[model samples]
Structure formats: structure tokens, C-alpha cells
Target: MEVIVDPINSAVETLMSGTNTLFILLGAIMVLFMHAGFAFLEVGTVRHKNQVNALVKIITDFGISTIAYFFIGYWVAYGATFFSGAAELTQNNGYDLVKFFFLLTFAAAIPAIVSGGIAERAKFNPFLIASFFIVALVYPFFEGMIWNGNFGYQAWLEATFGAAFHDFAGSIVVHAVGGWVAFAAVYLLGSRQGRFRNNKLVAFAPSNIPFLALGAWILTVGWFGFNVMSAQTIDAISGLVAVNSLMAMVGGTLVALMVGKNDPGFIHNGPLAGLVAVCAGSDIMHPIGALLTGGIAGALFVFVFTWAQNNLKSFDDVLGVWPLHGLCGLWGGLAAGIFGTTTFGGLGGVSFLAQLVGSLTGVAIATLGGFIVYGAVKQISGLRLEPEDEFQGADLAIHKIAASSMDD
Candidate 1:
């Protein structure tokens, strides 16, 4: 019996043939799973009464981001760039698909940021509305200018500086965006009741360690896709990216263990810190470099978390999004400039000056944009739940349901 293979169509083939698309699809799935991680992490961090609310918010934001990105965000970010038939956005090679996937991941992040701000008491409707704006309009615009081939600011940077700003995955775009927005939301929402009775900090331990651990693991796995898929090329670069990501995570874990003096919380979050730190340079860094970067990030997480809790009085980053995602993302981006290989050629290589500019630019954009949107929303609609809701819990007040059946 003779088996016949259909003629390979190049147009359709390019989309799926290379490592590009495969990496992208894998990244998308990995990032998607991070939502579960977020849910678990946030639920574990907050009071039992707010568990349902936290999970619901994460799930709803993800759903909204998927739909919004597919329809408007994707087109605006990638599809809209094509001029005539020559510039049509190709999906098979995974650029457009990657953009779509990244948008969803981006969406997951924004709500995660807000989770800390409105932890114990947030009205579901307001939260949902805020999510819509972030995913639909706000995120796409910035991402379009950065990663979208047709319209990204990277094109401008490449033309002007002779090299484009590097963000291997999204140390700046995804994580920082969420952090700044979360900062605004929390500021507007005000501190949790009795959080500071006489200008002193209070302790709010996580109720479920198992959930937090699961979430951290999920994020670790997802990060592999996040870092590797950013490299559109399928050569040694991809492998390097994966290796760097792993090394950094391992390094971060070790550092956290040493710094925390055997504390599980610090260790639990070390992998994530490592991933975030290496994200900016995953495609360029060697394995050893990745380990060093990750280790620093892990150590930083311990300090930042503690600092934020103690020193940063107004900012209630419930899951430590600002430190874990925002600060670490910035570190990764800057690190890329310092550590990026000149040997790689093209955008993967960078000078220290260029890296500094790019890192600052990312911070400026995220901070300014976040402050504006969050402030406006707060002024117009009042961004927090009623005091009554705070004492009772948002799950019951907003959703009229408990996170688990036990509450019922």
C-alpha cells in the first residue's frame, strides 16, 4: 500500500512549520495556566471570605481578555499594521498568534495586580468594568507600539538607536503594566479597615499555603513558554532562552532559601522571581548569567516584599505583584542591557546606554498610563467597596456566594 502526502502549501505551512508557532502555542497555554496560579496564590493570600471573589475576578478577567484580544485588541496590535496585501498579518509563523496569546497573558496580569488593592472588599461590577478597560483599550495600545511589527515603538527605536529595546518576554510590558495599575487602584481604594490603627503595620498571613504553592508551580511552568516563545527564531536562541529561564529560577530558589533562613514563603516565591528577572534577557543570556540574575531576583523578592509590607504604607499589593512582577520586571529589562550578548547580532544584542533608556521608557509608560487610568476611574466611580462589605467580605457582599461550598 502506498501512502500519499498532500502537497505542502507554503502559505499555510509557514504558520505551523517552524519552531516559532509551536513555541508560541506552548507559551499561550503556559500563560493561560498562570491564571490558575494567580487564583490559587491570591485565594491563599487573602481571607477565606474573599476566596470566591478572588477566583471569580481572575476567571472573569481572563475570559474578557481572550474575547477582547481576539476581536479588537489583536487586530489593533498586529493585524492593523499591514498595508495593502503586502503587509498582511501572518498567523502561521506565530507572530500574530503570539500577540494574541500574549494579550491574554497580559489580561491575566492586570486583575492579578488589582487583587491586592481590593483584596477583602471589591464590588464585582466595578472590578469587571476596570478589567474591560485594561484588556480592551489600555493594554493593546501600548503593546501595539512595542511588540506589534507594523506599529510598535520598537520600530522607531530600531531606526533611531541602531538597535531596538529588548524585552525578551515582558518584564516591562506585561508585569509592570499590571503593577502600576494595581498601585493606582489600591491608592484610590484606600487601606483595608483597621489595617493601620495608629500608623502601625498589621500582619495578614496566608490562609492556604498549599494553594500558594500550587500557584507558584504553575507560574514556573508557564514562564518557560513566556520566555522561550518571545524568540521568533527556532535555533540555538530558543534553547538558550529555556535554559536561562530554568537557571534563573533555580538560582532564585537558592537565594530565597538562604535569605529567608528556611522560611517556606520566601522559597515558594523564589522561582517566580527568578523567571521575572531573566525574562528581559532570556534570549541573550548564557545559563550561568541567568542563574546569577535569578538569584538576585529571589533575594530582592524577600527584601521588596518585606519592605512593601512595612514601609510602603498605602500600597496594598496583596499578592506582592509590584515587587514580584513590577520591580523584578524592571530589573530584568535593565539586566538585559548590562548582560546582553553582543555576539548574537540583531535586536538581541544591546549596549548599556540603550538598555537603560529602554528600561526607563518602559517604567515611564507603565507608571504614567497606569496612574492616569486608575485615578480617573477612582475619581469618577469610587474604586472601593463599602465599609460594610469590608467587614463581611466581598464574596458575600458582591457575589452573594462563598469561594467554597463550606462557606455556604
Candidate 2:
């Protein structure tokens, strides 16, 4: 018997697939644009002398990351590849291709986060190599386990805790991993010269408030796509995700303003901290729960950033990413359990134990991966610049140019 394909039904399916493909493609573009925010954020925070390097690193890492992800990372994570002929691979209106483009943006973010932590000191080539290794090897391994169930990690968690580990977006997957790796890089790279002089911490003012704020705003706008588009289909889109993100942003801003005493940097970054925390739970939590989660994250960033800079002093993380992305990503993971449960007036079906274990696993993997990768890179090619080079600043020493001619 020959099976007949219905033309009407086939046409409807094609149209729907095309629409979904377009929707996700737009989302990929928005998230890709977030790299500009990351670049500007680092540019504004680092001194004028290092600003060009900051701009260069974000795009360069993104370039390296695309290659790594295309060749290895996507296969490692999803067990899929584009090795097929173009005609064969173009099935489904090339939705899978656009999907890969979207996820690569998230992968590239790992290096963007680290660039801020090690700004003004790290060797550019070594750092790019490190980013390549991370996107190609480290990130996709864990990402495979979490997002693709490559290791049966999700199955094991579901058996033990009555639920699979839930990260609707990537609180632990992207932000936390980036943050912890940043910690290791910052640790190994050490503080900039004169950052801790005579056992007293010295302050480095932001190069430009306007640029920093621009970055924060860009990221804030892009994040709606980052969160909403995680649904990955027009059929699955929800107003709830958008509203939760908005509420969390508002909650974080107000709290950071109060806690930071009107500091412009903190004020701008506060919404980011909130957005970071809400990523894991935005799909499940009520707007009220999201508001609470954002508030706590804002407070946490302010408190921890102050402590890390003024007191800890082991490493100088210029953007405080360890707190902003690392700690808040951890909080986001766990908050998905707390705020995503019926106990917190959320949509429920999450397990606290699962969230705890999954979040911890992400941290452990990030920390250990950071040590191994950065350690090897340091030994092989050297990670930091020479003292003299450091004194001259990254833009001039590495890029052979200044952010502005006025500085020369």
C-alpha cells in the first residue's frame, strides 16, 4: 500500500515550521546583540587605556567560540551535527541551524564574562584559546548533561527528587558557569598592578558611566529574548515569562538603589542581577515570586561585590561578575525550586533537592573545569601579560592603540 501525503496538511505544517523558525531566528539575533552590551560594559568599567582591548576581546572570543561550537560544542551538547549536505540539512526550514546560532551566543557569553574579570592583564591569544577550549569541551559536556540529557544526570535527579532538574533558560548553565570560571581566571591572573597597594585597596573609577549604562540597558532588552525564546517555538510563548522578567527587573532596581546609596554603576547593574536570578524560574514562578527573587539577588550583588573588592582582594574582578553572574546564577538555580513551587505561590512541579544538587553540580563542574583549563593554558602559553606590559595597559600594549588619541 502506498501512503499518500495530503497537500493541505503538508502546507500547514510547512507554514508553522517557517513561523517558528523566524521567531527563534529573531531571538538569536537579540541574544547575539548582547555581546555588544558585554563589550561596552567592560569598556566602561576598565580604564581608558584598556578599553580597546575590552572591545576586541568580546568579538574575538565570539568568533573563536563560533568555530568551536560549530565543530565540536554543538555535537558534544546535542549529539547533532551539520555534517550532512546542505540540501539534507536544510530540512525543517533550517530551524536547527538557527537554533545552533542562538545557543552559540550563550556559549560565547562565557568568555565575555571572563574578559571582565581578567581585564587589563590577560594575554589575548591565551585567553582566546581558553575560550575555545571552554566552548568546545567544558561547557558542552555539562550542557549536554543538563540540556540534552547526555549523561542520564536528569534521569537520576528525577528518580531521587520527584522531578528533573529544571533550568528553563540557563541560570547555572551559562551565567553560573561563566561566573565560577571567572573566579578561577581572576585568581590565577591576580590583581592588576597597584590594585592592592601597601595592603590598602585602591579604587578604579569607571571610565564612562554612559557606556556602562548603555551596556546594561542593551542586556536588559536582549534578555527578554534570552528568556522568552528559550521556549523555542511560537506555540510555547507566554506572557507570563515576559511579565515575570519585568517584575523582577523592577524589584531588583529598587532594592539596589536603596542598598547601593545611589551609585550609578550599581543602579544600572541591579536590573541585570535581578534578570540573572529570574532566568531559571521565569517560566514557572508568579510575578510576585520573581519580584522577591530579584530583590534578593540585587541585595546579594551589592553586598558580595563590596566584600570581594574592598576586603577579599585576592583578585580584582572589575565588573564583579563573580557576584553578578556567579552567585546570582546559583541563587537563580535554587530559586527555581523555591519560587517555582506551590509553597511560594508558583506553578509547582519542582523539587528543592533536585535544584540544589543540579546547581551544585554546575558550580563544581565550572570550578574544576576552570582550574584544569586555565591551569593548562597558563603552563603552555602563559595567561597574563608581563609587568611592564601591564603598566602600559592592554589597549596600548596588546592592541598597539589607545581608546582615545587624547590619552596618548
RMSD of each: 4.3, 1.8
TM-scores of all candidate predictions against the true structure: 0.87, 0.98
- Candidate 1 lDDT over 264-319, as tens digits, reads 77898898888888887888887887888899889988998888778777767677
Global lDDT of each candidate: 0.74, 0.93
For residues 1-408, what per-residue lDDT tens digits would candidate 2 score against the true structure? 123457777888999999989999999999999999999999998898899999999999999999999999999999999999999777899999999999998899999999989998899999999999999998998899999998899999999999989998899999999999899899988888898888999999999999999999999999999999999999999899999999888888989999999999999989999999999999999999999999999999999999889987777898999999999999999999999999889999999999999999999999899989999999999988999999999988999988888745
Top model by TM-score, which number? 2
lDDT at 93, model 1: 53
Error of 2 at 396 (Å): 0.9
Candidate 2 is scored at a TM of 0.98
